[model samples]
Target: MKKRSMAVMAAFALAAAGCSGGSGGANPSSGGAKPADSAPAKTEAPAKQVTLSYALWDKNQVPAMEEIIKKFKEKQPNIDVKIELTPSGKEYWQKMETAAIGGTLPDVLWMNGPNIVKYASNGMLMAIGDQVKASGLDLKNYPESLVNLYTVGGKLYGIPKDFDTVGMWYNKKMFDEAGVKYPDGNWDWNAVVEAAKKLTNPGKGVWGIAADMNSQEAYYNTIIQAGGGVISDDKKKSGYDSPEAIAGLKFWTDLIHVHKVSPTLAQMTDTTPIKLFESGKVAMLWAGSWNAIEFAKNEFTKDKVDVAALPKQKQQGVVIHGLANVISAKTKNPKEAWTFVSFLGSKEAAEILAKTGTVIPAFNGTQTTWVKSTPQFNLQVYIDMLSYSKPYPVSKDTSKWNNLETEYFKKAWTGELKIEDAAKQVATKMNEFLAQEK
Candidate 1:
């Protein structure tokens, strides 16, 4: 599909980016004694109709997942399936938390890396080793980085659903107008800055970039470039105090406040950088491949918008995260619930998921066709990036720390706080967080 120039990306694409993902804690189903590995041990209870609720936040993919459930019904006509959507982003987390406290979480939940540790650590998540073994999901089949995200304390609590890596998304028409050649994977930070400067035409509302301030979006890449760890060896120290790390962050800070090539922090909060890019007000947005699905909307076909890996800093790396399917330890119907969870992790399910264009399925090789589902942009970057991808930072409180960075980052981005001061304070606060976590 050709990309759309000066065209608006479908509105949902922007919403998808802002929507934060989370899941609730779940206990084993009532009387759901952990079943034996061989066949699901039959229950002595009456064979009443069983309803399994699947909770997901992305409304866009709900339709596709529902289709899979329909197929599931063909196999087990007696089991009824229900679909529930948690409002996208933060609201979803709150809802999940409430469900967790109430012990009414859906039978199967979408699991993101950040909260898996928090939930699994609390013993709310069901152990999926038996399910994976039964479903024949050899942990070795998945990329180590992705599988590691949900594996804690030697227990694999989640089944890999899909994974995506970050990439640079650019507006093709803008590049042509600026007489700038398209960026290649080989481009460096200096090249990125130079390109952004040429792409700018503030008088006309076009800027070179929608500078991403999210650490998950930018700083993780920067940390790798700086050759510093996001956390120390003991996982109890902040790596932000290093000069290289500061320089890494300054790359974006300079682009906004100093170089004046992107919107200010306040501006970004109101109008997302990607929306600006899609609307032709900006030229580039660094986002994950999970987004490529929504960009499949009518406007972005045939080279109008496209993707490439981010310009290299001191290091060449990318951030990759996958959503997993985790069973709640609190589930009352483990035998029945495990069947659904196992089915979702099977190659058959991955194939269905791959067809939806919602995410890059985790069952390797199944993701090959996902990029082809989009016409507006080149999805090759995301595929290539996976080879060099690293896991997003993990912690018992990924929210507490990431939220801290997001809130304080605006200070540096808005020019209200100097970069050094901002980085220094961030380091201090991060260290303090590490201290408390310990």
Candidate 2:
């Protein structure tokens, strides 16, 4: 799934308590009248029916999720589930925060790296570590990066659902028409520059690539490749002002300004980079594995496009991020919620998701089918990238600094400010925000 901007919510305190009561059997006939009565026959209580609300943002994955839910229902007949779809981005987080405040959040919902810390730290999500231990669920079945992504403050709050990494998507037809060699794993940043130069054809009104200013799909990968980072290892400071980070930022700026091989920020804003690629206006695009289905379904790109690993800079690097299934802290049906979430994290559910070709299932052995699902493209590149992938940077109040990034980075993308100047500004202000996170 594509990364979305999260909306900040004011923190609110909440407390929950559990109570239990039991009756002592036949409190010894103190009244004397009941001593002669026969002992009552024991009767078993009927199972309680439960309906769980599952909230998610991506409608495209609903079918696969439904299939999993159908299988879950066969095993858990008393627990029915309802799916609630909300458009991703600010709206989804806004609604979630509202639900958190009101204690009306769904029993189960999707969580991502950026907001996991915020929610889990605020006690808005249930910690599933104990449940995982009790169930004897081996987390080694999922990628270590993904398992770590959902863990906050030594507690696991979410179960990994799926993962995605960025790749270089190229239009084969454009490459053939331009007589340019196809990109491969061995290619480096210099190779991309040279190929882009050869691929750009002004007379045809086609740019070599769409170097859009996106984090996960663009600069974040470049930053790590350049041996810089978005945040410090401690997550307490910004690394944007470092020389390596500046070099990473310059990579895209040079693509737009120095070489003129990419569409300007304004041009991309008018027609998104994906649209440009879909319409054959750009020869190449960098996007997540989630775009495979859409590209395969698109008329222009279905047969003509293929994927390759992103070109290396100082070294090979890509940003890895994924979604997780988390339970709401306020959910009344905690037992049922855990049951459903635990099922969702199982190998069976991952296999079902892989078969849909919608995502790379986080479960290790299950991704093979997902790689095979889209045979037209080299979907395995994304899987291979996991070897050198870095986790997407995040902090407790990620949205706060994320907003600052967009604000300052846009100026650099548009050539309104030098890349170094803009990055430095972001680093300064981002550090200030980071200091206030607690």
Candidate 3:
């Protein structure tokens, strides 16, 4: 239950020894010309078998990943891939760091926005921009924001796999009990506020909504909707001190402090927003596209819940974030590694992932399959938001400032500090970090 921003952890992993500064690397050497006239017999040397470790953190997606690996072997009969699963969060990053230090990091692995800059900057990742160009892979096949997210210093380090956007999920059962109509496209911030007021039933211990301090699902979406940018377009300045940004932060704090519709920060300490929605303790949950698979499979939610695009204020907004497949710079089999990464980025591999309904595939046309995979809810809301989706805010070393969000935001969530005051403090510290990121 760490915050979603932590989904992309700090880039403090030490750089590996001898990593190339750029995508440059030695090509596989081919056999030399046959000896002049001494040939008695010619025999093709046996193909060298290679075993590559493919690391990923999501156990739920392992089956699909293995299916992709299985398809990869048909084309690469001499190469074998071993699945390496790691529980996400700190443990996974720590293990990755240890492997990098030992020069044993997985040949192919998952990458995210926060760590791309760190790894690419330190030369821990292989630059695949050349391979992508050589293969004629159209960057347009995926969202441009995603491509830009994984690129650092004009070098592309990863290829997008899947993306998620924020949405409002409501329990139809609760809406009916509260006599409030279900949310829809016509809804706006005022509509939500009005409905939430009618939906709260303290006697039943159920609140109208969950206004947790989750930036991705809550504040980030609202901030953008309120015409506030999280960071300057250049990534060199913090936007938290703007009046628009303060208004956005106050929106949620007001829900907890003035509106009395959302659970208190203390009340939510043991249970998360998603959990409250899942257990029917809350009417609505602000969540991401990633929740589709979980909601489809959960007995309580599968039958009673549905989703709608987030209500807007000044603008339509939601943060779009995705994961990419990348290769380790020190991988012994760069050719094979690229082959696997390439396959993961292809439409076929995307179809396999889409069938699981776990995420919205980055491949252009494969999203429809994911939408149809689940009929219980309107998954199209996620895809619809894509047109206006804003890339999650990031920088060369997002971790440097990402950690500071919880530190400063918690005070406001707990009502220990004024929302504007807390936001200004965060902006001051975030600006200090932005200035140092050369």
Candidate 4:
């Protein structure tokens, strides 16, 4: 849900004290009584005071982060952490890239799946595998997919912070008004279609769903549910042109064009799908677990919304993505940065973040509080979906192909290009990019 960044091993070494012994007897020339042999008092050196810069995009999570920082301060009084909030993911990444070029990147920052490989391959991130091992931080404490997500070229560059998956969010009031059965795990694409048809009301200006062209929250999950994938497992080719992918694409496009049960691309562009759903203009929204806090706080939708597993297609599946905390390779306070990063990844930090309801903490066994944070909604759907979730697809230079996806998919969504043709074109271009990665 939140786009982010790696981990560092903190190594705290207490300054060892040295002892100097005096002669048992004083010098006879001084005429002083024999002085007993005594060692100088041992004193440990004070730890060096270090300051670390932590960058993140989500302002909503700042409170939780600050709370974590407060606890970290008590543990390491010498280390001072400052939070830099960028607010926008696009601007955040752009700034990170510029900072990387200038070697002024933050000591610690959030890293996402799409940018991890690019950053790690370019040596912009510190390889923390050895440090993590030396610190005795068990990688097994996190999901294997997430741990593997931050690992590049046999080296781990980050530690997972949190994970998210998609679910179908529906307005209970709308469902009740339409007298349609609420969706559940058993519902498939056909059931979704039938429900959408029954729920659409042109007079009241309410759409059955908001079929936004979001990769993670919308089409990606459907693509996987349809038994399709965006890229091959080997990362050597594209799967966009496959019939299954097309079917997945059609599921959204048809809702807009054939079924007339969703808003058009232009409408969604003007007002985001989340806003539409929040305003009660859309009956259902496919969104990520990250929306829980916002939805729970919204006045209009707070008590009227609930989530269910995304309707099944060929099989049950969802796209799983997460944020990791990583250290900049250029950081001046490498040890201090690692110390803070290590603390952030600890179960203590995870529990703190979980109770805040800001995110589903990646540390195993720490998500129950987060789920319970919003008791009215079935937040557990997100955690349950993890069992069958597919890791968000990515590769070296994912942004290049990602841009291409947006460019061509827009044409398909607007009906300027047919879904089949657009998908094939994307596949051809994506394959070219993949080949170049070799």
Residue 26's lDDT in candidate 2: 16
Model 4 scores worst on lDDT over the 10 consecutive residues at 14-23
lDDT of 2 by residue, 127-168 (tens): 988888777677766666677778889999988788888899
Residue 160, candidate 3: Cα error in Å is 1.2
Q: Is candidate 1 or candidate 2 better by TM-score?
A: 2
Per-residue CA lDDT of model 3 for 1-438, tens digit only, reads 345223323334432111011111111011222212212121122267888888877766788888988987887787889999986544666677777555577999877776677777766799998888776666667766677677888899998888888789999999998789999866888898889889898888989998888877888888989999888889899999999889889999988898999999988888978789899999988987878888888889999999999988999877778888899999998877877787788777888889888778877667889999898889988878777777678777677677778888899999999999999999999999899888
- Sort all candidates by TM-score, best to worst: 4, 2, 3, 1
* After superposition, candidate 4 runs with Cα above 4 Å error: 1-46
Task: Choose 2 or 3, whichever is better by TM-score.
Answer: 2
**Per-model TM against the reference:** 0.85, 0.87, 0.86, 0.88
Best by TM-score: 4
In order, what lDDT does every prediction score?
A: 0.69, 0.80, 0.78, 0.80
For residue 362, what is the lDDT in candidate 1? Answer: 71
Error of 4 at 280 (Å): 0.6
Query: Cα deviation of 326 in candidate 1 (Å)?
Result: 0.8
Candidate 4 lDDT for residue 302: 88
lDDT of 1 at 54: 80
